[model samples]
Target: MTHPLRRGAAYAIGGAACFAAMSALVKTVGGDLPNSVVVFFRNAFALLVLLPWIAWSPGKRASFSTRRPGMHLLRATTGLAAMYCFFYALSQMQLASAVLLNYSQPLFLPFIAWAWLGERPPLRIYPAVLIGFVGVILILKPGMGWAGPAGIAGLAAGILAATSMAAIRRMSDTEPAVRIVLWFSVLGTLVSAVPAAMHWQTPSPTQWSALAGLGVIAAGGQLLLTRAYALAPAAHIGALIYTTVLFAALIGWLVWGERPDMLSGVGGLCVIAAALIVVVMRQRGSRTARA
Candidate 1:
């Protein structure tokens, strides 16, 4: 059998890459369109993509037969809030800074789970989380040119995103992946409609294409992230999601000519190292648990 952690790692990594692409698209489109409008199309198109899957997958009929509507509702609402925050941050800051701040979810997962699910993590993760945040500081260099308020907004986005993720972890215990996604999609579309309508701007054909692509990428990432969290504890795979930053850095550099200085590079390494330490130690602990 494939080890659960490894499988979860694969899903998390896949989700990270998808998210990275989506972030790029957000930045690309956010220049011309409002963030709320982008969020609306993102959720709407994601549901449209999921429609066929929910219809065609084997045993898919049962995907919506969920008893945990409240959980799904909560997850969707929190997720929608996070989506707004993240896209807003993306619009207001450099792609790398926004992504780095948002990926700080790994630092908050353990505490959120402890408070919400009573899952106390290993003490070792504490230092690892601190190191990851330190990496974030290095990346932001707060006293430097990184915009003061926008950077803080990005940090808030990460916390809200982590809260939404923890809700996903709990729902995954009893919910099919499609069901969870369906609820979020439907709810996000509804929640974002008013705001999107208020700020609506007609996208050019090229921007429309980008928005559609964002939706598809968002769907894939959501499914993968939900599956990964279902297969293991949130903290176990949370670190793997940091790979999104590296991917974001590549996109930022090539497409936008943005480059992080030496200090930021060192900080990125620290963040990656912190996450790797957690993953490796978690793997070792998993072996011990299995024994």
Candidate 2:
């Protein structure tokens, strides 16, 4: 039998794979649909999927009595901003580059934890964080002068995502995970409505199919992620999350004929390695504490 930890790791990997598939679908649709429209439909469909669970479990509703409503709104706003910038960056840049930039979230996690949780990570995490940043710099290659405003937007998206995730961690103690996701879907959909309406292009039949598929895939990804977190610590699963980048790169190559260059390939590997090191260190620390 697989160990519980390994099973949780599998869930994390599966979630990343599902998310990667969703990203591929998003990229396939490309600039054909506006980012706002895409975000709205994605969350709207996800909300539909979660409705059954909401109805079946009354406890889920009760968990929303968050003491920090302002924090929830702030997190939601940042999350929406991250999604917008991410989709915009994907439209403008290479998929692998954008994925690499976004995966820097794990590196930011330590700093956010220190600031928000008042818990400093051990010194070992510093080298891993530095290595991860180095990978980002390699991917950005200052001398190349290839980056533009979109690249900066992508970085901002990463920061916002990391911040939102930290806020989620903080609130998780007081709220159930399902409620957090439900709020994200509802709030994100409502927030995107204005922009989606403003930039609405009547999706063709094929585009409509793609949008439906994107929503289903995104919902599945979120479900898997939720299950994974229930089974293991976030730090234990963090490294496995990088698998999404590999999945994105593969999908981009097969569907869009985009390939990662030497810099991106090296940098991507470095980032993944650093994330893995961090996860391993965290797991070791947990084991020691238990001992």
Candidate 3:
């Protein structure tokens, strides 16, 4: 029999692959569609895909009820903003670079938690954060004249993602995962619609197909990641989440001929290392609190 940790790792990697594929699909259709439209469809189609799952699981249906509408709105709004920035970055920048920047969410998470939850992280996490920012600077290459507005947008995506995560943490005590996800999807679609309508362009047949797949894949990846965390300690499989960066890099290289320069490559490594450190430390802190 496979060890539970190994299985969890497998599931995490699988989720990473799904997300990478979803990103690639976004890049594919992004050429013709507005980012707003893409964001709207992502939420709309994800809701469509999510409904069946809830329907199939009888118990999960009741999870939709929530006492905290305000918190749900905060999470959904921030998450939607992150999606807008991330998708825009994907449309404009190298797939690998955009994905790497988005993954830097962990670098901002500590500060967000500190501000929102009044939880101070350990001193050791600071060095990792410093190293991660150094990596971010290298990737941005601002002084070298390589970084562009898209790079800023990509980094902004990370910050917004961290904020959304913090909001999720705030509500995790009383809110079920299903309810949180449902609220995000519902509010995301509704909020994205105003912009989507302003920028609507009928998608081509191929683009329509890709957009649909993007939603389904996004929801599937979320489910796989949830399962992975349920099966093992986050410290055991958190690093596996970075496989999305590797997979995105591979897809970029093959599909778009994107090759990050040496600086960007090194920076990506730094960011990944820093994120892993944060994940491990966060897990340790959780365990200590429980003990």
lDDT of each: 0.81, 0.78, 0.91
**Per-prediction count of colliding residue pairs?**
0, 0, 0
lDDT accuracy of residue 207 in candidate 3: 92
Candidate 1 local lDDT, 149-248, one digit each (tens): 7677787777887788789888776776667767777788988999999988989999999999999998889779978988876656766778888889
Model 2: which residue pairs collide? none
Candidate 2 stretches with Cα past 4 Å from truth are 1-3, 58-63, 282-291
Q: TM-score per candidate, in order?
A: 0.84, 0.91, 0.97
Tens digits of per-residue lDDT for model 2, 1-291: 248778888888888888788776676676788888888887787778877766676654535556777767878898889888877777777887787777777778768878998857889888988888888777777779755766777778888898998888888777776677767777888888889999888888998888888888788877777677778876767767888988888888888899778886788788888877876786677677789
- Lowest summed lDDT window (length 10), candidate 2: 57-66
Per-residue lDDT value at 133 in model 2: 84
Return the candidate ranking by TM-score, descending: 3, 2, 1
Candidate 3, residue 62: the lDDT equals 38
User: What's the C-alpha lDDT at position 227 in model 3?
Assistant: 90
lDDT tens readout by residue for model 3, 23-126 = 99998988779999999999999899887766666574437678899999999888999899999889988999999999999999989999889988899999
